[model samples]
Target chain A: MKKAFLSTGLLLITILILPLFISPFLVYLSTEILVFAIFAMSLGLIMGFGGMPSLGHCALFGLGAYTVAILSEYTANIYLLLGAAILISLCFSIVTGYIAIRNKGVFFLMITLAFTQVLFLITSRMKFWGGNDGYSASVTANFGFGEITSNMGLFYMMGFFFVLSYFLLKLFVNAPAGKVLKGMMENEGRMIALGYNPKTYKMIAYLIAGSMAGLAGGLYIYKTQFVSPALFSVHMGAEVMIMVFIGGLGTVFGPALGAGAFVFLQNYISTMTDRWPLILGLLFIAIVLLKRGGILHLIQFVTTFGLKLFKPSRSRNAPVDKQVKGKEQAS
Target chain B: MIELKEVHSYYGHSHILHGVNLKVNKGQCVALLGRNGAGKTTTIHSIAGLVVPKEGAIAFKDKELIGKTPNHISKAGVGLVPQGRRVFSSLTVKENLLIAERKSTSSEKQWTIEEIYQLFPILKEREENMGNELSGGQQQMLAIGRALLLNPDFLLMDEPSEGLAPVIIEQIKNIILDVKKTGLSMLIVEQNIDLACCVADEVIILNKGEVVWQGLPNELLHNEELLKVHLGV
Candidate 1:
C-alpha cells in the first residue's frame, strides 16, 4: 500500500514537471487527455464495478459541456457553472438510469444509447444553440486567483481534478460498499440473498459516474472553448468505451492510461491519415482478441515476470512453500 | 416464527408453486423433503422474496412479506442459504462474510466474523482465498456463515446437502444442528432424506407444490409406503 502511494506521488511529480519542458501544443494535448481520463474513469466506475455497461456515457459529458457553455453567458462564477453542469447531468442520469436500470445486459446498453440519441438530436438541430455549427463560449474561466486562458493553466487544473477523481474512485472501490458492488456484479442473486438492493447500488454508481462524466465535460469545454453535437455523438460514446477497454476494464487507473494512450495515438495517427478510426478499431479488436486484461494487466504481467526472473530460485520454491504453509494451517 | 399460507408462485405464465402452506415455530428446525420439480426451492424462494408469490400470505413474526423485495425480506431478519451455494466468485472468503454482516435487533447473540471463523476453522485458514477456490463443502460452510452474519431471526436454507460426499453431508448436518441450537428457526429444503431426518425436529413432504405429509422425522422414516409414493425413496 505504501509502495502504491510512493509510485503515485512520483508519477504526479513527473506530470507536474513534464509541462515545464514540453511545448504549448503538447500541454494542450495533455489537458485533453486528462479531461478524457476523468471521463473514461467515470464510465469505468459503473461498467467495471457496478456491472452497468452503458453506451451513452458521453450524454452526460456532452450535457456537462453544454451546461457550462450556456451558463457562462449568464455568470462567470466557475463553481456555479460547473456545479450546474454536474447537477443537470446528475438529474439526467437519475431519469435515464431509473428507466435503463430496469433492464439488464443488451437492453440496458440499448436504452442508454437511445437516451443519448435523444440528447444528440436536441443539440444538433436547434438553431438557437448554434445548430450544427456548435456553440463556442468566448468567456474565460475565473478562478479568483486569475483568469485561466492558457493551455498550461488548463492542463494543471485538469491534472488536479484527474488525480482527485482517481483517488475518490479508489477510496470508493476499496470501501465495504465497493466490495458489495463487486459482489453484486458477480452474483446478483447472492447479493439479493445477502440483503443488498442491486438496483439501488447500480443506480448510485450510475449517478456518480454520470456526475463525474459531467465534471469531465465541464473541464473539456475549457480546453476547446467549444461545445458541439459531436460531444453527444454516438461516435464519442463509442470512443470512450474503446478507451475503457483498451486501457483496462476493471482497474481504477487503467482508464486514465487508456485515455492518455488513446488521445496520443489518435492525434498522431489522424495527422498522418484520414482513416485513423479504422486503425483504432483494428487495435481495439487486437487487444480484445489477446484477452490479456488490457494494457494495465500486460504491464502487471511484465513487472511480475521481471521480478520472478530476478529471483528464479524463489519462484521455483513457491509451490513447495505453499504446500508447507497449507499443511501448517491444517495442523 | 415464519408462516406461509397458500403461497402460489409462478415463472412468467407457467405456475411453479400451487397454493403451498407450511409453518416453522420459534427455535425449531423443520425439514422440507421432496423430489425434483416438487417446488421445494420455490417455497424457500417465496419466503426469501426471490420469487414473489402471485397470491397468498407470507408472514414473518406477523409482518406481511408477500409484496416486499428480496432485500427487504432479508433485512426483516430472514436470511437465506440458497441452492447451489451461490457464493460470490470474485470476492474472498472474508469479503463474502463481511458483505452480509449485520447487528442482531434482539438481545439474542449476534453472529460475528470471529464466531463464524470459530464455527468453520477452515474458513479462517482460507480467509485470503477467493470463494471459487474453496471445495464444495467449504463453499457450503461459507454460504451458511455468510447467511448467519445477517444476524437473522429465521433462516431459509435450500438443498444444504445437494452435492456432497456422505462425510461432508454429515458435517453439514452437524453445522445445521449447531445453527438450530442458536435459537434461530430454520426451514431447510432437502433432497437427502437421511440428512433431513437426522437434523429436523419435524418433517414436511411436498409433492406438486402441496404438502403431501407432515410428521415427526421418526414417523417419516417408519412410513415406507408414504415415502415410496411421494419421494420414491
Candidate 2:
C-alpha cells in the first residue's frame, strides 16, 4: 500500500512538472494522451475486470462526443455538456449492454461492434451534425474556473479529469461489486448458484465503463475542438482494444500506460517512418507472445529484478515479499 | 421440503432425465444413488435451476420452482454444491465464502463467517489462499462452506465424495451428518454407496434417468442383487 501511494505520488509529480519543460505541441499531445488514457481505462473495466469483451465500446465514447458537440451549440456550460455526455452514454450502454451481454464471448464482441457500426452510419449520414465532416465544439464553458481557451489550461483540465476518473475507477474496482465482477468472470455459473444475477452485475459494469468512456469523449472533444463520425469507427474501437491489451487488461494503471505508448507511437513513430503501423503490429505481437500480462508485467519484472538485486537478504521481509508475489500472480 | 414430479429434461437433442420423481421432507436427508450416466447430476441441476426441465412440477415448500432462474431459486433458499467442487478458482477462500453469503430471512440462526471457520477449521487456516491452491478435500470443504454461507433451507449437493481419499471421505461423511443434525433438508447425489447409506434417512436409485427404486438406507444396503443390476457395484 505504501509503495502504491509512493508510485502514484511520483507519477503525479512527474506529470504535473512535465508541461513546464516541454513544448506547446508536447503539452497538446500530453492532453490527448490523458484523454485516451481515460478511454482505455474505461474499456479495461469491462474487458479486463467484468469479463465482458465489447467491440463497439466506441459507440459510447462517440455518443458522448456528439452530445458535447450538439450541446455546445445551445450553451457554453461545461457542467451541462459533461452531464449530458454521461447521461446519453449511460442510456446508450443500457440498451446496447442488454443486447450485447445476452451473448457471450465472440458473439458479445460482434453485437457490440454491430451497435457501433450502426451508430457510425447514422452519424456519417446525418448532415445536421455535419455528416462525415463533423461539428466543431465552440463552447466557452469554464468548468466553474476561469476561461480554458489556452492550451495549458486545457491540458490541466484534462489532467484533473484523468486523476478524478482514475481514483473513482480504482475505488469502484476495489469495492464489493468489483469482487462480484471478478467472481463472475472466473465462474458465472457459480455466481448464479450463489444468488447473484450475473446479468445485473455485468450491466452495472457496462454502465460504469460507458459513463467513464463518455467522460473521456467529452474531454476528447474539448482537446480536439471537434467531433466527427470517425470517432465511432470500427477501426477506432479496435485501436482502443489494442491500447488496453498493450498496457495490460486487468491492471488499473496499465491501460493509461498503454494509451501513452500508443499515442506516442502514433504521433512520433508515424512521423519518422511510413511503416509505423507495421512496427506497432510487430511490437503488439511481441507483447502478446512474450508477455500476456502486457506492459504491467514488464514493469513488475523490472521492479522485482531491481529489488532482488538490491536486497539479496530480503527473504526476511516476508510481508513485502508476499505482497509482491500476490501482485505478480494477479498480473 | 422439496419435491420433483415427472421431471423430464434434455441436453440439446439427448434426453437426460425421464419422469424422475423424488422428495425430501423437512429435516430429512435423501441420497440419490446411481451409476455414472444415470442422470443423478441432471436431477440435481434441474432442482438448482441450472437445467430447467421440459416437463415437470418442482415444488419447494409448495412454491413452483420449475421455471425460475438459478439465482431466483437460490434466493428462494436452495443452495447447490455443484459437481467437481466448482469454487471460483481466482478468488481467495474467504472471498469464495463471502461471495455466497446472504442474509437468512428465516427465524433460524444465520451462518456467519466465524461460524463457517469454526465448522471447517482448516478453511480458517487457509482463508487467504486462492481457491485453486487447495487440495481436492480442502476444495470440497470450501465448496460446502461457501454453500452453507448462503444460509439455505435446503441444499442440493452433486457428487460431494466423487474424488477424495478414504480418510477425507470419512471426514465428509461426518460433516454431512453434522449438517443433517441442524435440521436443514438435503438431496445429495453420491456414487459412494457406503457414505450415502451412512447419512441418508432414505435412498433412491436411478437407472437410465428414471427412479428405479426408493427405500430406506438399510433396505438399499440389504438389496445386493438390486444394486448389482442397476448400479453395477
Question: Which candidate number has the best DockQ?
Answer: 1
- Give a tens-digit lDDT track for model 1, residues B119-186: 99999999989999999999999999999999999988999898898999999999998988888888
- Model 1 scores a TM of 0.92
| B-chain TM-score for every candidate | 0.98, 0.98
Cα RMSD for predicted model 2:
4.6
Tens-place lDDT per residue, model 2, A234-306, is 8899999999999998877899989999998999999999999899999899999999889998899889999
Per-residue lDDT tens digits of candidate 2, residues B161-232? 988999999999999999889898999999999999999999999989999999999998888899899888
Across A18-105, the per-residue lDDT of candidate 1 in tens digits comes to: 8989888889899999999999999999988888888999999999999999998999899998899899999999999999988888
What DockQ results do all the predictions give, each relative to the true complex? 0.88, 0.79
Tell me how far the alpha carbon of residue A29 in candidate 2 is from the true structure, in angstroms, after superposition. 2.1
The collision pairs in model 1 are none
Task: Report fnat for all candidates as fractions from 0 to 1.
Answer: 1.00, 0.82
